[model samples]
Target: MQFMEDLKHLLDISYPIIQAPMLGVTTPAMVAAVANAGGLGCLPLGGLSPEKSLALVKETKAKTSKPFAVNLFAHSLTSEVSEEDIKIMENYLEALHKKYNLPFEHKPISSYRFYNHHDQIDILLDEQVPIVSFTFGLPEAQILSQLRERGVKAIGTATSIKEAALLDKAGMDAIVVQGIEAGGHRGSFIDKEPLPQVGLISLVPQVVDTVSVPVIAAGGIFDHRTIKAVFTLGAAGAQLGSYFLAAEESAASEVYKERVLSSTDTSTELTQAFTGKWARGIGNSFMEEMKNSGLVIPYYTYQNSLTAALRDFGKSGGIADIISLWAGQSASQSKSGSTEALFNKLIQQIKSDTNPIF
Candidate 1:
C-alpha cells in the first residue's frame, strides 16, 4: 500500500504505469495521450540536437498540462572512427546499397556529433519540465540538484543492482530497472566490460530491496499480467515500450510496426551493427551482413548517422529487410489502438479482481 501511494505521489500519476521513452519511435501526441490518461509519459530526446529537443518538449507541453518526463542519451560521442575504419564499413555496405539501388557513400565524419546531453539539460531547465530521465549513465549530481531545486524529478535507468544503487546514491527521485528482456538500447553504463543480463522477474525485487527510491520495472512487460508480476516483485511501477509501438500517435512506419507485430519472443538479437551500440532489434539483412562482415564504427549518434538514410529510404519504400524493427521479447503480444484506448484496457486489467493487490 505504501509503495503504491509513494509512486503515485512521487510521479503525480493515478496509475502505476509509465510510457517508456522511445527515442525516435514515439510522437508528441503519444506522450500527451499517456499523460492525459493519468500515467507518466516519457519523451526520449536522443539523436536530436538541443534545439530540436527543446522544440519537441514544448510541443508535448502544448498538448497536455499534466506532468511528463523528457529523457536523453547519456552517451559520450568521442568520434573514434578513423577514415580507414569508415572505409571498411562503407565498402561492406556498398554492395547491399547498390542491390537496393540507393546511392551509396560514407557519410562525412564531420556529419556526426555526439554530446553527453549537457545542452539538453539546459533545455529541460528552460522548459521547466516536470521530470527528466537519463539512460546509458547518470547526469552530474549538481544537475540533479538543480532539477530538484526547480521541482523537476530526476530519474535514471539501471540494468543491474549496482547501477541502481549508484543512481540511488546519486539521489535520483526514481530508478528504471531495465532487465535483459527490454527492447532497444542496453542501458548498462557502469561497466566497460560485457554487462550481465538479468531478467525482470529476478531483477526488480533485488533493485527494490537495495534502493530507497522507487523502482520502475522495464523489460518485456506487456499486458497487466506482467505489470502485476513486476509490482508483486516489489517494483513500484511498470514501464512499457513496444506495447505502444502501434499506437495511432506513434511515429513508427507501417513496415516497422508489421515486423514488430510478427516477431517472436526469440526473434530479437542484441547487435551493435546499426548504431555501434548494443540494442535489441529484429534481425534483418543489414544486421546479418554486418554480423558476418565484422565491422564496428563510432558509438551511437555517430554510427546511427551512417545508416539514417537507408532506414529513411526503407521506410519510404516499405522495405523491411534494410530497416530496424525494434521490439522487446514480448513483441508478438502487442496490440494496435489509440493510446487512450490502450491505456483504458490496461486500466481494466489493473482494476481486475484477479489482481489481489492494488
Candidate 2:
C-alpha cells in the first residue's frame, strides 16, 4: 500500500501503470491518451534530435494537461566500430538491397561524440517536463542533479538486481525492472557476455527487494491478471509496451500491428539483427539471415544506421519480412483499438475484479 501511494504521489498520476516508451513507435497522441486515462504516458526520445524532442514534448503537453514522462537512450556511445565487421555487414546488406531492388548507399557513419543527452536535458528543463526516464544506462550525475533541482522525477531501467541497486543509490525516484520478456532493446548496461535471462516472474521481487526506490515491473505484463500478479510480487507498478503496440494511436504500421496481433507464445525470439543490440521481436527473414551469416554484428548506432534503408523499404512497401516487428511473448493476447479505450478497459478490469489489486 505504501509502495502504491508513494509511486502515485511521485508520478502525480491516478494509477501506477506506465505506458512503456517504445521509441519510434510511441507518438504524442498515444502518450496523451494514456495520461488522460490516469496512467503515465511516455514520449520516447531515444534516438531523436533535441529539436525533435522539444517539438514532441510541446505537442504532448498541448494534447493533455496530465502528468507524463519523456524517455531517453542513455547508453554510453563508442566510435570503436570494427572496420572488418562493418564492411561485412555492408556487403551483406548490399546483396539484400539488390535482392529486394532497394537502393544502397555507403554513407559515412557518425561519431558517437555527438549523441550525448546534454541538449535533450536543456530542452526538458526548458519545457519543464514532469518526469524523465532512461534506458541502456543511467544519465550522468550532473544531469540527474539538474533534473532534481528543477522538480523533474527520474526513473531508471534495470534488467538485474545489480543495476537496480545502482540506480537506487544514484537517486532514482523509481526503477523499472525489465525482464528478458521485454520487447525491443535490452536495457542491460553491465558488460555481461550473455545478457541476463531472468523472466518477469523471477526478476520482479528480487529487484523490488534490492532497491529502496519503488519497483515498476516491465515485460510480458498485458492485462489485469498480469497486473495483479506483479503487484502480488511486490511491484508498485507495471509498465506495458507490447500491450499497446496494436493501439490505434500507436505508430506501428498496419503490417506491424497485424504481426503483433498474430504473434504466438513461440513466435518471438531475441536477436540483434535490427539494432546491433539484443531485443525481442517476431522472427523474420532479416533476423534469420543475419543470424545464419556468421558475420559479426556491429554494435548499436553503426548497425542501426547501416540497416535503416532496408527497414524503411520494407515499411514503405508493407513487406513484413524485412522490418523489425518487436513484440513480447504475450503479443497474441493484444487488443486492437483506440489507446484510451484499451487503457480504460484495463483499468476497469482491475477495479471491477472480485479481488481488485489496484
Candidate 3:
C-alpha cells in the first residue's frame, strides 16, 4: 500500500506495477490485459512504421479503457548501410545459413529502413495516448513538452545513474532504471562505449539518490521479495518482464516460453551477438557461436536487421538454437498464467507479508 501510494497515484493505477514493454514479445492484447489487471501496461512501438504503430494503439484502446503506456526506441537510426560492413556480414550470415541448413544469401537484406521518432511522436499526439515512454534515450525536450502540454505523462528508461539523472532533469514524469539484468536490448544511450554491468540493488538507490523524480526499478524483479527489495532500495515501483513471458497472454513463441521457464539463474548471459547491442538472454548455439567466432559487424539496429532473417528462419522452423531467447536471471522463478492471474499472484504475495522489511 505504501509503495502503491506514489506510483499508483502518479500513473493513476490501483497497483504500482509496470509491465515491461518487450518488443517482439509484448502484444496489444497483453497490454490491454495488464491495464485491465491494474498495472501500467506498455506497448513497445520500436522499429515500427507510424501506420503500424497506430494500428497497435487502436487495438489496445479497443480492448481496455484502463490507463496504459506506449513505448518507443529513442536510439539513433542508420538509414544507409556501409558497403564493406554489408559484404562482411553477408558472408558471415551465409556461412551461418549453411551451418544451420537454411537458405544462403549473397546480399544483406534490410529490415526496417527508417526509425523516425518525430513521425512516431506525431502519431502518439494524434491518437492522444495516455502515457508515452522511451528507451535507448530521451527525445528532445521540446517534443516531450508537447506531450505534456497535451496531457500525456512521459517515462524514460535509464541503465546508469547518469542517464537516470539526465532524464529526471529533463522533466520525465518517471524514470525506469533498467539494470544490467533486464532482458532484451539495453535501453542505454548515454555513453558511446559500453557501460559496466550494474545490478539492480547497486543501481536503484544510487539513481534514486541522484534524481528528484520517481524511479521505477527494472531487471531481475520477478517475485514479491524482489519487488519489496526494489522498494527497500528506494524505487517507487517494479517493472516485470520475463516473469510474464510464460503468461497465457504473452506473444512469446512456445519454444521461447519453454526455454525461459526451464532456465536457471545461471543459464542466461548478456551478449551483443543477436542485435549488436548488449542484452541478457538464454544461452543457445547462435549466441555462443557468434560470440566465439570473432566476426566484426555493424552496430545496434543495423546489425540487428542483418541478423533478423536468421531469427525469422529459426522461429518459423522451430529451431530454438538460432533465435534470441531473452530472459532475466530470475526467469526460473517465473510462472505461467493469465495476465490477471499473475497480477493477482503478485498482490497476494505482498499482502501475505504483514510488513515487507525494507
Candidate 4:
C-alpha cells in the first residue's frame, strides 16, 4: 500500500489509480463512479468553453466529494484556416462525405478560440479543485507558480524523458509518462519527430530515473499485472483511458462501444485523419478510404473541425465507421460494465496480487 500511500498524500485518493482524462468520452457519471470507488477520476476540459468548463466542475463536485482532476489542452491559439485551406480540406472530404452519405454542405467554421488555461486555472482555483493536469505543452511560469501558491497539485503529460524533466523544472507536481501505446493524440512535448516507440515497462522506469518528481505510468496499461509492473518500475500511480470507454457510464456512443468490443488484434491504427494530429483509433472505413485517397489534411484542431459534421452524423445515425474510436493497444481487453463494477474488479485484482499470504 506504500504506492497508494504516496499517491494519496499527493492526489488525495483512496487508491493510487487515476482514470485517464479522456476528452469527449469521460462523462460525469463515469467520473463520479471512479471517485466513489476510491480512485481519482478526471474530467477533461480541453474542448469546453470557460462557462461550460465551470459548469462541468460544478456538476462533478455535486456528484462526488472525493478529489478529482481536470485536464486542459495547453496549446497556443492560431487563426482559423484561410479560405483556400478550407476549400482544400472541403474538396478532400467531399468524396468521402458523399461516399458515406454524410452532409456535403461545409458547416460555417466557428471563430478559432484557444483554450485560456489561465482563465480555466482561475476557475479551478476558485473551485479549489484538488488537482489540475495538462497535455500538449507546459504552462507559463506564472501559471505554475500560482497553482503551487494556491496548493493545487499540477501534473503534466510527456511523451519523452526530456519532456518529463522539463515538466519537473516547470514545477509540475508529477509527470504522466505517456508511452507510444497511449490512445488519442500523442502528447509530444519537445520532439518534432517521434521518439523511439518506448513501451510502458521501459518508459516508466526511465522517466522515474530522469525526473525528480513522481512518475505516473500511462499507455496500454489495463490489468493489475501492468499496474504492478509500473509500481515496481517506480511509478507512483497508473492512469488508464481506453478501459473506461467501455464502462457503461462512459459517454462514448453505443456504436463506438460495439466497434471496440468487436475489434480484432489488427483492428487499431495510428492515423491523423480525424484530428489531424496522430492518434490511435479502431481502423474503420473512413481510415481505409483516407489511405486510399492519400490526402493528409491540416493539424489536429483544424482537421477535427473539418470532420466535425461527419463525426456528428456518424454518432446520430448509430454508425461507428466514421467516428473516431480512440483506444490504446490493450483496447481489446476492455469489458463493458458499470464504472463501479469495473473499478472494483480492477482494485480487487490489484489487492489480491499484492497481498501477502500469512
Candidate 5:
C-alpha cells in the first residue's frame, strides 16, 4: 500500500488500481462499483455525444460519491472517403451478408465525428470531474494546460517509451504504459509501424526508468502476482480491462463474456480487419474469413460502422464466431463474478502476497 501512497496525490484513490476504460463494454454501473470499492473507475465516452455523456456522468454521480475518470478519443477527425473506397467496403459487406443470409442494409456511411473534446472538456470542467484520460493520440498543449489549471488530472495511454516521453513532455499527470499483451487497439502514436512486442514485466521497469511521470502498468496483468511485479518495477498503479469485462456489472455482451471464459488457449491475434487499425481479439470465424479474403478496409470509424449491423446480429443470436471479442492476452484468467468480489479478491491477493514476516 505504501507504493500506492504516491497515487493518492494524483488520483486520490485508496488503492492504486484503475478499472480500464473499455469502450463499448464498460458501463456506468461497472464504473460506479469500482469507484465505490476504492479503485478509480472510468467510463469510456468515446461513443457518446456531449448530451448523452452529460447524462451518464450525472447517473454515475448519483450512484457513488467516489471519484472516477471519463475517457475520450483525442484522435483527429477521420477524413471523408472517396466513392471508390466506399464501393469496396460495400462490396465486401455484401458478400458477407449473402454468405450469412442476413439483410444487407446499405445506408450511406455517415461520417463519424471525433468526440468534440473541447465541448466535453467544458462539461467536465463545470462538473469538476477529478480525472480525464485520452487515447488514440495526444491533445493540444492548451487543452492539457486548461485541465491542469482547472485542477483536473490528465492521463494518456502509450505503447512505447517514446510515446511516454512525449506525454511527459506534453504535461500529462501520468502515462499508462500499455504493453504488447493489452487487448483492443494498440495505442501507437506516429506511424503504424510494428510495435515493440514487450511484455508487461519488461515494459514497466524500462518505462518507469525512462519517464519522470508516474507509470501505470497495463497489459496481460490479470492477478495479484502480476500486480505485485508491476509495483516492484516502480509502477504506481495497474490498469486492468479483461479481468473487469467478466464482472457481472460490465456491459460486455453475454456471448462475448462466454467466449473469453471458454477460450482454452490465450490465443489472441492482432488483426486490422475489424477496424483497419490493428487490435487484438479472440480469433474467430470472421477473423479467419477476413484473413482469407485479404480485404483491408478504411480506417476505424468507417469500417466499424460498415460492420456494426453484422456484429450486433451475430452477438444477439449467441454467435461468437463473427463478433469482435476484444480480449487481452491474459483473458483466459477471467471469470464471472460480482464486481465488488473481484475487486476485493485482487486487493486481498496483493496484501496476502506482500505481508512481511512476523
Candidate 6:
C-alpha cells in the first residue's frame, strides 16, 4: 500500500479518498464534512466568480482546519457564437419555454462570458488552498508554476493516456483518470470527433502506467468494493462524485436527490443537450425533446447560459424532468444520509475486509 501511503501523505489526509468537486452540487458544508472525516474534500469553484469562490473557501476553512482541495474549469470560456447559431438554439429553447409557460428572451453575448480561472487562481493562492485540481484541460504553465512555487499540489483530469502524460510532464502532482462512465462533463480536452470511451477498469491501469504522478480513478465508483477495485487496478485513490449527490450536505434539491437515489445503471445517458458539452445525466424529457428538435447545440458557456433560466425554473419548481440530474453509471448504489455517516459506513466496509488495501 505504498501508493496509498504516498497519496495520503501528498494530500495530507488520513485516507486517499477524494470527494469529487462537483460544481453546482458540492457545498462548503459537504467539503468541510469530508475534510473533517479523514478524507480529502474538494470545493468545486469551476464556473463561479472569484469573489464567490473566495467566500466559499473562507466558509470551508471556518468549518475545518484540515487540508482540502479546490477545483477549477480550465476550458476556454469564450467562443465565437454566430448569430445563426444563437437564433437556432434560442428558437428551440423558446418553444420549450412556451411549453413550460416560462418567459423567454434573448441573451446578449456578455451573458456567456465567464470569470476566467486565472483570476480564480489568485484566490486559491491567497487562501493558501493545499491542493488545486482542474478539469476539461490543463491550465497555463505559469498557473501551474505559480501553484508549485506556493507549495500547493496540482492535480489534472484526463480521459486518455495521452492527456495523463501531458499533465504529468507539466508537473502535476496527480492525475484523475476520468473514465467514460463518470457523471457530469466529459474531461476529454483533445479535439476529436468522438470522445474517449474507456471504462474505469480499462482507463485507471493505463493512466497509471503512462503517468509518473499518482493516478486517481474516477467514474462509476460508488462503494467499498469499487474503491478496492480501483486500488487493485493500480490507482492510488478514488475520486467519487455521484456517490455523494444524495449526501445530506449536498446542494442538490430534494427532487434531484430523489431521482439520483431511485435511478438504476440504465437510467442515465451521455448527451450534449443541456450544456452543449457531452455530460452524463439521467435522461429526461428535455434531453429527449431537444434531441428530436435537431437544432445543433452551441458550445459550452454559450449553450450553458442559454439554458440557465430553464434549469433555474426547474430547480425552483422541484421539477425533476427539466433539471440535469448528473450521476455516475452506478448511481443506483449510492447511499443517502449525512456525509459523516456515509464516510463512516464506507470506512467500516473497507475495514471489514480481511485484507484491506488502506
Compose the digit string of candidate 2's lDDT tens values, residues 105-132.
Answer: 9865543334546668898998999899
Residues 128-242 of candidate 3 have per-residue lDDT tens digits of: 8989999888788898889889999999999888888889888998999988888887888875666757888999999989998788999989878999998989889899998
Taking all chains together, the TM-score of candidate 2 against the true structure is 0.97
Q: Rate the local accuracy (lDDT) of all candidates.
A: 0.85, 0.89, 0.85, 0.82, 0.82, 0.89
Reference-based TM-score of each model: 0.96, 0.97, 0.94, 0.93, 0.94, 0.98
Q: Give a tens-digit lDDT track for model 4, residues 1-358.
A: 4544666789987788889999889987889889998898999998578899999999999999988899987776663456666677788888778977766776556665546576588888999998989997888889888889989899999888778888989889888898888878887756356644677888888888888777889998888888887888888889999878888988889999888787766678888788877788898888887777766466657788788889988898898888988988888888899999988988888768745210
Model 3 root-mean-square deviation: 2.1
Better of 3 and 6 by lDDT: 6
Per-residue lDDT for 263-287 in model 1, tens only? 8889898888888778888888888
Model 4 TM-score, 2 decimals: 0.93
Report how far off residue 32 is in candidate 1 (Å).
0.5
- By lDDT, the better pick of 5 and 6 is 6
Q: Candidate 2 clashing pairs?
A: none
- Model 5, 274-356: lDDT tens per residue? 77667889999888888898665777677777788888888788888878889899889887899889988898887777551
* Decoy 6 TM-score against native: 0.98
Superposition error at 228 for model 5 (Å): 0.5
lDDT of 5: 0.82
Name the lDDT of candidate 1: 0.85
Report the C-alpha displacement of residue 147, candidate 4, in angstroms. 1.1
Q: Write model 6 residue lDDT over 59-151, tens digit each, in one string.
A: 999999999999998987655667788788998889889988999888676555586688799889988999999998889899999999999
Candidate 5 local Cα displacement, residue 155, angstroms: 0.4
Clashing pairs counted in every model: 0, 0, 0, 1, 0, 0
In candidate 1, position 176 carries an lDDT of: 95
List the candidates ranked by TM-score, beginning with the highest. Answer: 6, 2, 1, 3, 5, 4
